[model samples]
Target: MSNVISAKNLTLAYDNGRKEIIKNASFNIKKGDFVFITGPSGSGKSTLLKSLYGQLKPKEGNLVVGGRDLANIGSRQLQELRTHMGIIFQDYKLINEWTVAKNVVLPLMIAGYSLDVQETQAHRLLKHVKLSEHADKYPLELSGGEQQRVGVARALAKNPVVILADEPTGNLDDYSSNVIWDLMENACQQLETTVLVVTHKIPTIFSLPYRHFIIESKGVYEVH
Candidate 1:
């Protein structure tokens, strides 16, 4: 498999002036691979996800994604690279005041796409996520799971090559979680995109066809 993201002796920590979250972690995510990052709370799952999306720069070693060394990329280059990556968090980061269609089209707007094209693309993705009927509705009108489904649709709007999801199914019921997982799996297969999802949900251990990586003892390793 081709590697889409690679980390070598990568380290991350908060400025609390105390303990580091991820310590000398090294791993590679191959293109089109669906990998799960699992561990106990505070084991650095979220921190690691953040680093992959360029939110938190590693305090220590080299980190590369899509053939670009993240540690050395300029802000403009980072922005361009990030355009090819999608990130989803536990919370559905939707604009409450905007319609669902508007929320899903925001990324395209930021990327300077035309208004008509953005609307068409947003509607198509909303249909893909099974939320087409709710396009004119507000975030407050949707359930938590529905909001997340919209998030997933928006994440795919730019045809990203890699997707990093942190606790994506944390608050959903079994059916909703399964739906989200299936959608992600399909997206990866159809687009040849690499997916790294972080979650503590036990059911995930047997839920999907993913290579599991456990974060423990300040290191990351593929589990048997």
Candidate 2:
């Protein structure tokens, strides 16, 4: 399989102080693969995901996403690279003022997709998230689980090449967590979208196939 993300001896750090968070880290995530990252609170899992999305710049070694090397890209090139990625936050970051449908269509709108296509795709995604009936409501009108479902719908809006999720189930109940996992599984199994989720731990039981990475000693390793 072709790799979508490849890292070797990468160093990630904070911009202000150049304080390293992840050092000499190396890994590869293949296209259409489903992967999970887990570690303690300050383990730099989020930092790694930020690097995938170009939000963090590596200070050393090679870090490549899709076909672009992060160390070689300018702002324009970095933005272009990010066009193929989608992100789901731990908190549902939907705009409270916009209707659920409108919020879900934000990415498509940004990409200049036609209104007709936006509506059709948004409805389809909403249906998949089981929120078609709540499309007309605002984010604040939904429960935590429903709001997260809207977040899922929004993340898949552009048919992104990969989806990066950060603690997507951290705040949800078991029922909602299962719903979110099922949606993610379907995205990988049926839609063939690559997925990388950062969480505190991996579950003991899962029916779908996925790789597990863990951060320790300031490096990342494939644990399963």
Candidate 3:
């Protein structure tokens, strides 16, 4: 399989290079691969994720995603690249004013889909996430897990090639976390989506094969 994400000698720093978080890390994630990146607090797991989505530029080395180089990508080019990616955050970033269904269809709206098509896709995704009953409810009205479920639905709405999740299950209970895992696994298996998740713990419920990497002392290593 071809690589969907590639990094070579990637060095990430902050405060104008005064402090470096990830140094000389190299890895390649192929299409349809399910990857888990784990580390302790302040270990730069989230920082590395940010680089993947173009939120943080590399201080050194080459980084590529979906066949586009992020080293010196312009604003317009970066925006175009992001449309093919789905990002899920630990802190569910849903619009409070929009209803659940509307939040889920935000991507479709951005892509200029008609109202009918957007509503149809949203309904299907809401059902998949088991949140169809909460379609009209506001995000704040739901529990943390429910809100995160909506976030997952929104991320999958666009049928993105790669899903980048940062500590996706950090604040969830086992049941909810497993629910999220199942949805992501289905996306990988059925939809052929590449998934890269950064978490403190990789749940034991995963039945499919996956790749695990750990960040420590400013280096990334594959776990067997």
Using TM-score as the measure, what is the rank order of every candidate, best first?
3, 2, 1
lDDT of 2 at 187: 84
TM-score of 1: 0.94
lDDT winner? 3
Compared with the true structure, the alpha-carbon lDDT of candidate 3 equals 0.95
Per-model tally of clashing residue pairs: 0, 0, 0
- Stronger candidate by lDDT (2 vs 3): 3
Error of 3 at 223 (Å): 1.2
lDDT tens string, model 3, 84-203? 888999999999999999999998898899999999998999999999999999999999999999999999999999999998998898899999999999999999999999999889
What lDDT tens digits, residue by residue, belong to model 1 across residues 95-157? 899999998887798899999999899889998999989999999999999999988987888
lDDT of 2 by residue, 4-81 (tens): 889999988896536989999989999889999999999899999988898878889999898899988899988777
Clashing pairs in 1: none
Candidate lDDT (C-alpha), each? 0.86, 0.89, 0.95
TM-scores for all predictions: 0.94, 0.96, 0.98
- List runs of model 2 lying over 4 Å from the truth: 15-17
lDDT of 1: 0.86
Could you tell me which residue pairs clash in candidate 2?
A: none
Tell me each candidate's RMSD, in Å, in order: 1.7, 1.3, 0.7
